[model samples]
Target: MQRSPNLANSVSPTNIGHVVFGIGGSTSTWGNRKSYAESWWKPNATRGFVFFETIPRKHLPWSISSPPFRVSENTSKYKDYDKHPIPQAIRLARIISETFDLENKGVRWYVLGDDDTVFFINNLVDVLARYDHDEYLYIGMNSECHSSNSLHSFEMAFGGAGYAFSYPLAKALVTNLDVCLKRYQTLYGHDHILQSCVADMGVSITHEKGFHQIDLHNDISGYLSAHPQSPLVSLHHLDAVDPIFPSMDRKESLNHLMKSSKVDESRLLQHIICYHNPTNWTFSISWGYSLQIYESLIFPSILHKPLQTFTPWTKVIRPPYFIFNTRIPSNDPCQAPHLFYFDSHIENTTRGGDYILTTYTRGKIRGLPACNHSADDISKIVVFSPIRKHHLNGSRRECCDVLRIIGRDAAELKLRDCLENEILP
Candidate 1:
């Protein structure tokens, strides 16, 4: 595809101000899920609206930090809309059309997401910056579970994960969405309907790894800890997955992640690997989220694969558990990873330069013995990284050098760009 000349020489860069969000919500569900949207939505600075079915009755006095609410137009006029099991799918799918009709000025992209979707705003801006907003673009990812993909479409962008439409494409969608919605009233999900409409326009989805549907249930630590080499954008379906951080409730866990996200949104859950050669210990740091320590040296190829720590979205389990390569978690002491969760972080200014110090505390102790006692004493990990966004377009993930053990209970490490021709053996 040819780059638009206007975008190529564009003096102004795409920022949060250029994107408008359309949050799919309802009066019944908005009260409980508003906190997730509030976590990322900035009042006045961020432009967008939460489209609810009706005015929220119980949750009055909406806070300023949350996105201002807009009630969706009644979809009762559409034929056969009432027969759909989840009739709200019609309203939810029309979010793009509703959002575009408002005709917010200077809007380059229209971001669509559920109320439970938590966007990493800065990272989102950075990801969107790579694309030409003047073109007809539809960007998003399919579900993590293979079953979900098989049932709906691997090509469709799951709405809960959030997706983006460029200005031109959104305009086209607004014009035809009502008729398209009528045609697809039998479709079950909002995302599928949207994808069908986009397909009618001959526009296929431009998959971005950063947008996560998070369709799995129970513990999702495995997936988050081994993120793809992309900017962390949005996470959805938080209510189904276990709390990202151990011990904390779902809301608190998200708040805990916000601490590190605020420090460097681009680096949140960015995977970096290093080794302590003497102990043959492999350290996998999911920046700002969790850390996993292996007693024996694990090659980057194996380390990069997420452990199968989550179950499929449905009870019917079949082949192809996940869309990505996942290693089955082992009961063997040698293979089991010692877990650590993000504890705190601080900005450090020194003679050399500015950096961040993030500490990870050991979680609950498993009864299994540590392999050779190499990682037994270690209770905390302190990682130092440059205070800048790690560019995702780079050829490889940034490398890390395991520093000398600072204490009996803690270890330290430093992250830097991988030296040219350098490989993790």
Candidate 2:
């Protein structure tokens, strides 16, 4: 059998083709972004060039091509919202066209980054290598700030942390942008518009945990040093967070974050794990790896919580840093191409045993029709979630039962206890 795709291994710059960096920022941030590009992306930028698609500004110290993009203050969601110049959002098509023009030069990937976004080029190349760039592809993290994912696809690659477009996708979008422009939210924002445009093209954003759109307002070093054991891809909102190096400047922060791009193994949770359940207690799985068990089964923490509680937790079981690895390859989720991200939160409730649920970030909500997978393909795609068991206060250790991912509704999965592992005949 083939081994799972690994982004840890390094790849050469040539193999990465052309990853066009679409840096978005207003006049105030343009200087900061340019400095960031020179300091961070450019020096390490063997794989791509920074494409700044913007209109000219006075004393801005930079110039851009005037590609005659339409700027509309009107959108389906927001009206008369001229928070920024209209040209900012309109430049997306031009950037794509410029990259498509490089199709003759074998430009394979187009990456979009904010003015403050910092990317680990090596890790990016390695990650992109796992997928075929020739196919219709849009790779990035899901919307961390967008609440209503259903209204507008959460499959959007948050532009803050930056997203990518394969050669084929870039071609389709830029080529048909004029005709497709009328169909999407023009002034909604570059990212939302792009997501709407791509969804129309039958391609969804592929989520990768590495690319971080750090939607926060604090120092991230504490979080980074304790990051999961995966390749650290890209980071955005550098200016928003505390300096990577305490009391240091942006240059120092960027350097420190990049230099310390080492993988995090503090939790030792990596792959998906599956276990057979044979007990009376029903399993409540959430946050991707954490499990909550009770006599009566409950809902996935991701989606909802039952009106009733899981069993009264008299005991607490901490398994000396739980195992997060899984034998199930993520690509196994047949027909539905989604990138699963593993994460968790500790619930220190005064009521019962402190609960923590492992959550998997399900990408898009499309049906399995797009999957077009054979039964064999579906069979091979088993979601091996993590499982562990514990006893009451100072009680004996309980046996480990299985927890299953019932459906794509990560928020709600009915997991029942089974006596034996569900082995296929």
Candidate 3:
């Protein structure tokens, strides 16, 4: 694959994103969906961004800061589309179908994502840099692999996983929008509808692993740890997985992905370096930096080079950490299924800033499509800890914790249990 000439000196990918939320008449529906689009998607939006596109309504509480623009639905043409499920697909298709008409806006790529979907702008651009924006490219990953032989095509990209139309493809779709809309209605799903339209335009779906549909039931540790040697483009099903470490909702996951990719800056969890120790499906754990992966049945098949911040387009995957159910009893901090070295003695700790820890079992929670899965093919568990303020200079004995037993794993891990009684708020 050749690099886009446009990316010669550029630091980020060129993307103009438009987020669509399936409509609803209920105030709560509109409000919840609006909160996600505004609060979650608004901050990280790209240059040619268009915020909340809903049908025109009376006085609604809609506002955003400078830079990325916002678009209210009522002001748009598809405003009258019903809040019903079926019509929502038609409305989304119509909105997408009309995007290219606004060409010459210097947008190399036009992204189509749902309200729940989260985009990793930098990684997205890096991934897009590998392809020419002028090419008729429809880039995204497939729907959940479990639901097969259904209306959705295995080859087509899923909407929630987030699919994008390159400039040329967007232009092509605009020219035949109505015809395509009439050809495939909501019964096929908006994603499928877009796929069929592109197929007719002589466009084939180009698959990428990073764009996640997130159709599983629970525990993204399996997915994240074993994520392909590719930049994570987008993720959906925000309301599913429990938060790990610092955040309480999907935003934390988004923050996690962004920070891991160096998108956002936080003194804590910064530059997490992993070392690939040979073991079963295990790849590697953070080298002596608090976290460790242990227990296994397979010969450490994971081998990953250290991740660099300014990684080149050549690097394919993230630091690898294969997830498995089999356990081993190695006390070597590195070999424990998961070990957290917290300096209970706070004064001696070198890593500055407050310490917080949040966690979830690798494969317990359920999600969107409801995958009836049993295998513990987990990648890594995210720990979202509640913060407790305390002067670290005065401390006690350091304590180390590892997930070697079942009590800590099966407790449906909650935010309350993780917090001390004094810090309860």
Candidate 4:
């Protein structure tokens, strides 16, 4: 029998160098989708390939900015794959085994995703650090849309959002994958096939809130504005949703978000709730995404739930649309929160320490009325945040203080570690 793969013996903590990516794509779609991959891919630093159905004859020289490309092992020889409705599922599923075959030295995990998937590399590294790579672990999250879950197994990680396997699990899974593919030939998607194979080994998905399947469509601003208290790992299905920030196309919007992420990836899209007791104003900051300023003092519990501003992936399925709790979006202008989109960031070095100031410019929503004149003049929000390490477990959500209005047009807020007994008023 072949010996088990040796685990890395280094005493240092797991870093980006320890992981490799296996991105699934097709030549037909690569031209448009490659931009998404390039946005997050580090050319020389990141390891792995974008496995295409076949390389294009016309697109001769591949750009250096994107991940290198490779053609997946042809599955037509496998008679069992013919039974699957989507023939491409077989090729996509095989990416796992093919990536493992590369045998990158010192690799502890194999992350799989689609061409459209954008990974936050720093956050991804931090998340993978939480698990023991030597163990048989499957880590990822399910879809946001409940109907999609009803159609597909909720236990399975959605491939578009991406998922990871500890080295040992991937090694073992690939050994039995061919048989599993043949056995589960009726499965609709590659993710399901892999999930079926992983289940046979008695492993379940370790859900991480940060990995977004983005099963919902239309303006996802509401969902993103109230992110769960976790470091964002990946975002998929950019083509399905509207531009994250208004006035920009999908690629430009992604580039814009990356600006703040470059400064501090740990804080990107991490939610923080603060209040101005004097004006009874509520501020919901989805760091690096958008900020919503409410006219009333919304309770922390209520503010934490996402506002259902987008439609479900499948209209065929009925009520209770999303898996998580979502408050009905208000039509009343007075109740609607004033919107502000991230515009730019400024990094500062002081004798005390280093901090980042991200600016969010107000977006004019046609019917949104100013509930309070106190906040009417504010056109921008400048947030002061000191860099801190992101810990996935047993760590309290950082709190923020609404500082004095800097000018008639700009609002300032400062972030700080919460007092043990502190509660938002």
RMSD of each: 1.7, 17.7, 13.9, 3.4
Q: Report the error of model 2 at residue 303, Å.
A: 22
What is the lDDT, from 0 to 100, of the residue 56 in candidate 1?
79
Query: lDDT tens digits, residues 201-284, model 2?
Result: 898778776777765445443244323434557777677666644545877656533432322211221211223233222332
TM-score versus the correct structure, for each prediction: 0.96, 0.51, 0.58, 0.94
**RMSD (Cα, Å) of model 1:** 1.7
Best by lDDT: 1
lDDT of 1 by residue, 90-136 (tens): 88887888888885689998999999999998988887888888889
How far off is residue 284 in model 3, in Å? 3.1
Clash pairs, model 1 backbone: none
Q: The CA-based lDDT of model 2 is what?
A: 0.46
Which scores greater on TM-score, model 1 or model 3? 1
State the TM-score for model 4: 0.94
- lDDT per residue, candidate 3, 1-425, as tens digits? 23446564564544434222221122334444444454334344443334344432442433453123334233244333333335556656665644444333666777777766666655566567667676799888875433421336776788877777777778788788767666675445777878898999888888786787766544444334434445556767666654433223656444444433331211122112222222221212221122334333223233222221111112225422111122323333333344232111112222243334333223222222211221133323433222332111113211122222232232111111222322101
Better of 1 and 2 by TM-score: 1
- Backbone clashes, each candidate: 0, 20, 37, 0
Q: TM-score ranking from best to worst?
A: 1, 4, 3, 2
Residue 389 accuracy (lDDT) in model 2: 25
